[model samples]
Target: MTALVQTVSKSTLLSVVSAIVLGFGIITVAGHVQAATLHDAAHDVRHATGFPCH
Candidate 1:
């Protein structure tokens, strides 16, 4: 019997690391931001995009 092993390419590893860093940064910043501020930002974006948040 033979066992198969797989390895990650450099590009794939870099992409995964980048995504993890970006996600962590967004979460950390969001945690420190006030809920009302986030709501206002989202509300304004909704209006700008004509998504009808109201």
Candidate 2:
């Protein structure tokens, strides 16, 4: 029981750490992007994901 708990705790902690790292990376990269470039990227992503941009 204790071993199972420890394993779950470790997995949860790893997931949280990974999410934080990815979020920080996105924020850092986004901060350096120009407004028009970011808008274009978002528009492309929306189209690729089948979201109606118009």
Writing each residue's lDDT as its tens digit, candidate 2 over 1-54 gives 678657677779789889999998885454434467675767666557664454
Clashes of 2: 0
lDDT of 1 by residue, 1-54 (tens): 122213766788789889999998875444434467665666655556554343
Model 2 — TM-score against the truth? 0.44
Top candidate on TM-score is 1
True-structure RMSD, every candidate: 7.4, 6.4
**Candidate 2 global CA lDDT score:** 0.66
Q: How many clashes (backbone atoms < 3 Å, residues ≥3 apart in a chain or on different chains) does model 1 have? A: 0
Predicted structure with the largest lDDT when compared to the true one: 2
User: Which pairs clash in model 2?
Assistant: none
Clashes of each: 0, 0
